[model samples]
Target: MAEKGKLHIVMFPWLAFGHMIPYLELAKLIAQKGHKISLVSTPRNIDRLPKLPPNLTPSIDFVKLPLPHVGNLPENAEATIDVPFDKVKYLKIAYDGLKEPITHFLKTSSPDWVFYDFVPFWLGSIAAELNISRAFFSIFTAPILSFFGPVPVLKGTQEDRTKLEDFTVRPKWVPFETTVVFRLFEIKRVFNSFTGDDDDVPDTYRAGAGIEDCEVLVVRGCSEFEPEWLKLLEEIHGKPVIPVGQLPTTVFDGGDDDTDDAWRGMKEWLDKQVKGSVVYVAFGSEAKPSQAELTEIALGLELSGLPFFWVLRKQRGSADTELIDLPEGFEERTKDRGWVCTSWAPQLKILSHDSVGGFLTHSGWSSVVEAIQFERALILLTFLADQGLNARVLEEKKMAYSIPRNETDGSFTRNTVAESLSLVMVGEEGKVYREKVKEMRELFVGRDRQDGYVDNLLGYLRSHRRLKLEDQSNGGQRN
Candidate 1:
């Protein structure tokens, strides 16, 4: 603990912005509670962080490390939102190479604990070896985390991977009926490649990623939103699983004056539409759909005939294509019925707007929570890891509908896209899903009224700090 009654802590996050931002928010909250946080990242990302809160900035320390040489990633390419996929690979290499420095910092600085995102599998073990307690922080909601526990390992040839009927059928152990079972096989294939025999990375670097045992597992469980998976994680890990509810305060508070302007603009636009008449569409920061798919989605939105708002990134292409070109006059055609915001928007604010009837989303946990918190109906279109599982949960809960993508190739055709969007926007089934979402949203808001997530998280942190201090005192006396 610091002399001024602050607990000294360190935070290490994976290279991705989505993963890093939430963890940084948590750190900021802890700092508000009189804790000093040392955040570690590649030099590029550290340089890119929006300006920090004045008070928190001076209290928190930033540690920047070099990226390992991989390929043609430019030196200035650290914090740019448009980092290429190959560059992301290089950043991972850089993150991997910093194991020694990280371990050294853990050993020397000896903070109360360290927090890590997905990176080295051996992170927990390394922290243990350094005699430091560590926490595994996952940005995923509980249900998504629950699915990753022990499951029957499928042993089959590559050809067997394609049978949708075989894949959709549930494994005997998994307790849900899903049309999405085939999707799990796809994830398994990716996992296998990362852990396969031909891979140069050690098994320790691949399998389990050292998360087998952790002192504590921290989850973004804002709103008591994911109960089933939360219970499952407790059962699987046999450790304290802490759901630090949403830490709402940001390091960059969007400046003092302009913050209200974005909120006011969205609210004004939303007020003009009927209740549940507009669709909000946004792929998260890291997800970039192909130009063809982007066009297909746009056409689908045009077909749906609902008022909508789509948030698009300025540049498209990460690990996929170099440029994403939209159809001519696409923006103009939709201008009366829709608005497209460049770069980021006030996502939470938009979701909370009355005119914002439903969300056409990528099923990111953060976005999912926001939708639930505001009680907006959802149309799920997932593109990456665990998002499929999240989409399944929302669909199962009757709070959302998913676009049926081709199982073999993971493509969303126009018909499937149009129908799914309608299901959330105007269909009878869409109404039912919307009502269910309303119910869940009501439940979440009621819970928030009684016990807001931010306050709960702060209380947990204080309790955790006290528990650690007691444990240390007991150990000292015994020694």
Candidate 2:
């Protein structure tokens, strides 16, 4: 060890871009406090990580671990993007193989703490072996976990939760008024996407183990937005839960939109529109829309007759599917008022643009935080799992309007999509939502507030420096 006062932390997030980026952000933030961060991941995922600041580069090290090749898993397919949705659990199986390599690194590195993702529930044992403490870096917000609840619910230890429809209704622990649960069709879509059916072998069981085994639950949450949800987590897990404010709340204006070629075209498009007039649409890297859904979304934008910036993604396995899904002559007709992009756009930069006033999102937690951070009014198009619950939270908080889809089956029409987009972007109902977005943006993701949460977390880590191997009996306890 270099010194007694310094902290050495190892971070390992799940392979998904959504999960990994947050862990990277948190690692960067923690490094700024003069702590060393050993961020571990497969080489492919590490390459995909967002750029880290030059000043923090020396303190944050990438601990590359090779992904083991498994049968049926495509060569070099180490992340969620590399495989179809059904093959994700195989990625998880490959991830579990890292325990041995990671444990070896921990043995040599002697890091004080390990901050882990939901999938590596076994890390607790590894940390314990190294006389190191571990915290689960929950990229999902408190509400998602609070609503997903404990082992009994997740493992279907109880009879009711085993079925798909059971989760459509609120979990018993959640407040019905603000409860955010999956829809029935959403439930079917989620379970069907997964390859496994046994609750004992599902990802939930693995995720909950980390929560139960960790010293504490560190979440990307802030009291200003989800105090009740935070409390619910504490009650359910009976462990210390720290809301490390929706992170990366730095005072950043993004690259010079006017000068940078990366954003030049997008900036030019926005400049052509009035301030607070464009709806920035993205559904994340995952959540590829089907042909029918893509058509509806495309026609929805056509029907809305508003300025928009839509990021269209090609469906996996087919390279030209983006062009195939668009309604005939749709792009040509909407060219003046809308822009369709097939590649990745700098999401935060687009959200921060003056002309971008609203967002049409999948309501994934990362997307949710990004929208709220920029004070963008939301038109939620929640597609799966926690996203449905996340949409409900925004609706209950009045922070955004959840699009009304078919109640029994989650199918939505182009008209409703147009109506929801119009309402969030230009209609009278959107006005109040925009106003609330501003208030929440200031309260939840304010730069100073997020900075303070990092400081608090660092302080918590420093307090654990004196912990020794003999404290095994109290390993799960958090201060």
Candidate 3:
């Protein structure tokens, strides 16, 4: 039996690092309150996770369940970082195979609540069978979730969105004036992902079922950022919509040592630059820009002529670790003012540096949180998923400036990229965005406010916990 007033919670995020890292953050937050946490993932993914704090080791446990073999999924490709973007469908196949083991685990351990991501659509039903409370924890922002609306709307029966044009406009359910809709090119990819027929388990069904089955809806943002959106989510879902805060990584949190040779060299280079003069470029772990787009970005960086440090990644859908080729002679011309790192660099340490002023990013929520935490200027260049929506929302908020691109084909020239980079980094036109983000930073970095959200969430969990018949003898009932 669980200790009095203590909860044993199970966290099961998707295989992607973006999802896993946030789940781990929540786990740590709960564990700090003397709750027991079991974070389940594949063996390899568990190995790649950042080490838990020494104090958390006792309360938080890593539960490994080996991924089942599936054709086309590369050997040992347990996480999205391991395989290319296109092969993630195969990874999903392997992920669904975990149902048996997870079900068995739940049957044995009987955690009070299970926090899960959208990928495991069926887990909710299993949790229901065991009378375990479950929450669909979304890493996406409130704006994106509000745009997608409720399960019935996403499931597409009444007033379903059929054509690509249907998604270009603001969703009717929003009930407020907002420009949080996807762009032409972005909607095409998002629409297909939501309604694709090639896979056995459609993402639309996963998202709808995940939402429908969960007892509550939890988002990764705060009411301060988008109060209206959070209210709209509660309206549409007809349940409590909780914002668990942005879950930003603390700057003082110890990570890789700066004395390491690679970090030392980068630190020295950054030290030489003027304060707030450098643009930090990274597209995060998942969103890989294509070769053509990368070439334009390279030439654009050269044209911008600003001091930069780009943490580049492999090409989209590539299985190899080798960095993709840049435009010929591109690196040589910019070598004096720019550094491109294909290998891992300490992102938080670099972002916190004095020389770093602006971030040219793919608009991932995690990346956005990091940028907002430091009050860095944002130059948005989105490639996939909810990133475009994020870019649109940030632009609407005047918190970031996006690169100019052809609306239909999502094509951008090197000149536009260069212009955007210059404008957001050093141009006078960027003052509004710079000021707005600085204002926003107060909320993002407020550790007290962040912790309060977690505390409130824990309180809700404690009050609402439905004890099984066996557990009733030990604690009676939560209420």
Candidate 4:
């Protein structure tokens, strides 16, 4: 007979790198425990997935689903990285179209558990129809989930939908008073996206609907970082809220970028810098800064008088443009101490190096977790989405300093950026933040600590079996 508790898990993540990476990590952990893992994605996304270890190759298999063709979506554009932000919605529409193909796969795979991302409101119904289990995997931190609260309040028709300021004050579901909400402009940017142009239904609706339907929340966070908030979510959701740790990351050596001229150039310069004195800067894959913001950040780095390495992704739509306009002669002036790369660099290798001391980042969750794993102090300049909230959590822990922006205009100046970066890398405050993050690194990177949370989640999933007969009686439909 087959092993009783040995389960088959299907992981379906959204088309964003931030979402897919964590889900892949979780799948790896579960597969390490001898459970089977089937990772489902569109063609290109599966091809681009992080290289699985040789051992895992035996336990996991990729199940490709063809993205449905949609008007205005570029051919082969199946993920957020494949299109610009404005075109991302078209990708979402195409993602929703995958329901049929995914359903077909589920019916055939018939896995014991299906772990899906924040989108895909229809998957719960599919799971119910198949009489298989469903779990929602949140790639966001506990604070982001807590800030949104439970499904009822966020999905309620009674709430106002126009002005972001209405919901930006604080989440309605938090029983205790707290100052955990987005700043005005951050709210404005998200609100602009929340109410889409055509508005058949926003992805937020899918998120909330999926939340209301899921059996549990398998989060990429740990109690050490967010105990109070995690507890609050369990109470509010009336279902299990499992913290899966930050999910340990393995650093890549001699990665795709290692041989590129920009990578070699940065490495040669970085090798000469004093240990723990250089700061590495790179926004995540999707955060494309505007020309004005880029100019300000460039000026700020120049004036900081510290050795730094900045990765400037090629300008959008114009792949060949090497560098955006920096202050005239700035590169020549700081050539010895400041090195800028116009291509992707090995961020994991750079951060893990002894010479790197701080990270100037856009505060994406995956980047934050990786920086913490390497004990690097953070200088957060949040750009979009949940980044503002993630920055606040680090600031609350005294582990990072966020750049100050104008309260009304939400614009930050070159001086403020310089000051924040300096304070985090060289000032007395930098020392305190560095020490605090170092302490956190031990807890964050410990294999035993991470495995403990995984063991708990695995045990729960093993014990919580539902009656297939009862589900069949209910027409085997997802609610």
Candidate 5:
């Protein structure tokens, strides 16, 4: 322990950028309170993270551990971004291989607490062996956590059996009225891709073990946004569940620099558009759509006739390289009304612009928080994990609209995309969603309230430090 009540904490997030970024944000927050934080990840991921704020350099350390070689996992493919969706399980296998190195680090460092993500279900037992208190810092929202229920449900021991039908409807635990279940297509995709093969560990088991092993469950949401769900989480888990605010990202805080010529051009275009008239479309760093899906999205934007700024993900060479090309003459037809950027366009700056009226997104929790902080309504078309759960929650709250899709096959047409875009962008029905987001913006952007959540988290960590068996008998805390 450091002098004057400061803590030495470890932060370990999953390999995905979505999970790593939030864990980084939380590390900074805790460091700001005069604690020392050691954030652990692979070498490439640490290098890819935004440069640390100057003042934070002394208080925070980035500990890089090399991922062990695993058969079939590409060389240097340390993160999910480095590989395709199908190959992610190999990344997990590689991630788990870090047990030996992480054990050496933790045993030497002997930190006060280790906060980790839902992946690495094995971490809890390791922390236990070392007698270091551990926390499961969830980057997901409360509704989804509640939907997955306590450890029993996540481990497939509940009455629901964790079957396909079980996911298509809201679980019985949520007494409040909500339509927060997966669609047929969504659940099938999850079952196929996320649930691993016989040799691979399933994601559900990971989440369960992470929750079961944690001293406290920390969520990336606030009580103001989902009080009932937060409350339900505590009851179901029979443990302390904390909400550390939304942790909203600011313009150019810790991402790629945004002052390039490309951003300047996009800014100029945004300046010329009418206020609240443009739809900013992005599906985050992950969630690559198929060629058919991408073509439909292009035609849908064209048919909607609304001004759009799309940040399309560049396709990798081996993954459908041939079909990756855009529809012929697409740029020629939509040149006047749309601009598609293949490179990174600072998302915070774009969403903060006056012209960006709505976000057409995959409903990733971080993206949704960023958009709401700027009062931009959502137009959801979820394609990957937990996004459908977020879309359903927002849809139930009447604060967003989802593009219609076939229930069984989960296929959506251009017409449905156009219609959903129109409804959320400029149609009469979109007014409710627009106003609702504006009203909820305070919950996301209120810095003071957010700071309070972090302070409370620190207080809990301090009070509940891993006490030695002798100290516990005398009610003494370790630090």
Candidate 6:
């Protein structure tokens, strides 16, 4: 290596909090191993760094890049969570412009390795050209990686399988009893439209889209969660599928005094509640429900009569006016039993708390992982992306239950919402799910005497580096 000083690493993540958060944790872990890390993102996001943990701030260097202006994008829309969906075009253009600066930075800095997310498909070839080893860091689980990677489908070779009636047709290569929905084809088409060229889609996207390729896959897994999927991924990839597990306490590190106070107050309120008695509801940053849906949800929560905490975003779009009304005196009616918080909350801390019996989530992979990590029983109400698939997997595994949606549009009705809330929060079914959740929590969180996921990850990283060094030295001798 470089005179036994420190290994330099560069990390580039897609401009989204869900993607950036995990990569940030990995970077911190690398830094702790005596490596220098440079994390590159837009200037707007870079400005938010001061609000993060001191350890994350000290261990990593931040590179602020300008967001190239494209038509229709707002001036201040650079932060991962702030960017709207329609401005994805501008983001692609901005990212494309970044390639040159990234190349120059690599040439000057000469990092030993580059860790990148799926959005920058071209980075692999660039890293190879610059003689830097590259690793793909997937924030998803192993089954997700395996499902989206170059695995053969049972439905035979076809470009678009939507025309086929039975979407549940398993692939020839997949050993498990699996089924695919026709809607997945529609999702692929949408993603392909945005990326411009089909060739540029990452291997995972391609595999999910029915294209095949040979590439290394990395996932976030541990011995306790989905071990079978991890084993299957290794078998399919024919390469080491490293499971770094969950990195320790980083996401909740930031926030001002006011924010901290709010979190503490919420925690105190939760602590007073009995175990498995509360329902936690949050739709991640990207998901904004319609006014009608939001009203329905509010009414449903009120009808459930369970102790609940709901996080509501302040702004609804121009077309949606439902949240503003709130059924006239609805807030007062539910004041004693329920709480509604505006803006941000410490999500990870809330999820891990004892009183949170069930999570009513949008089923984002990051949220799913967090829920699993905390071993909370779930009431899955998926909205978009692979979230539907995640919900299906959880239901199939009997780990969580899905809220029944409208047959025509797959949207949740108020009745369905109320029913699901009652089933997960206070009904007989809730008790059974709670026991299963407790067992899973014990498995993942581990016992008082044993080391949990974080320790296993640290051990894995050390062994991985040693093996890499051995391989490099052996190859040099051969040369």
Candidate 2 Cα RMSD after full superposition onto the native fold (Å):
3.2
Off by over 4 Å in 5: 157-159, 251-259, 316-323, 466-479
- TM value for model 5: 0.95
Q: Model 5: which ten-residue window has the lowest total lDDT?
A: 316-325
lDDT (Cα, tens digit) per residue for candidate 5, span 293-406: 898998999999999999998652233233355689998898988999987678988999999999999999999999999999899988888998999989998888999989
Cα RMSD, model 5: 2.3
lDDT of 4 by residue, 329-372 (tens): 87898898998877657788788888999999999988988898
TM-score per candidate, chains pooled: 0.80, 0.92, 0.95, 0.93, 0.95, 0.81
The RMSD of every model to the true structure, in order and in angstroms, is 4.9, 3.2, 2.6, 2.9, 2.3, 4.7
Q: Candidate 2 on 1-479: residue-level lDDT in tens?
A: 47767888899998888888888888888888888999999998888776666788899999899998876677788788777666676778888889899999999888888999888878887786666788988988998888778856655465446677777787777754665778777777787432255322576766777887788899998887788888889988888889898875332343443336757888888888999889888998778777788888888888988888998876643322243468889989998899898876878878889999899999887887788888888888877657887887888878888778886667788999899989878888678888898888766667789899999888777766655433545765332
Clashing pairs in 4: 125-478
Cα lDDT over the full model 1:
0.67
Segments of candidate 6 deviating more than 4 angstroms: 1-6, 49-58, 151-169, 179-215, 235-238, 248-256, 264-275, 314-328, 352-354, 372-375, 442-479
Clash pairs of candidate 2?
A: none
How do the residues 232-323 of candidate 3 rate in per-residue lDDT, one tens digit apiece? 99999898988999988642245564447898899999999999999999998887877788999999988888999999986533465535
For model 3, where is the 10-residue window of minimal lDDT?
250-259
lDDT of 6 at 281: 90
Clashing pairs in 1: 68-94, 85-318, 121-209, 121-210
To one decimal, what is the Cα RMSD in angstroms of model 4 from the true structure?
2.9
lDDT of 3: 0.86
Clashes of each: 4, 0, 0, 1, 0, 3
What is the TM-score (0 to 1) of candidate 1?
A: 0.80
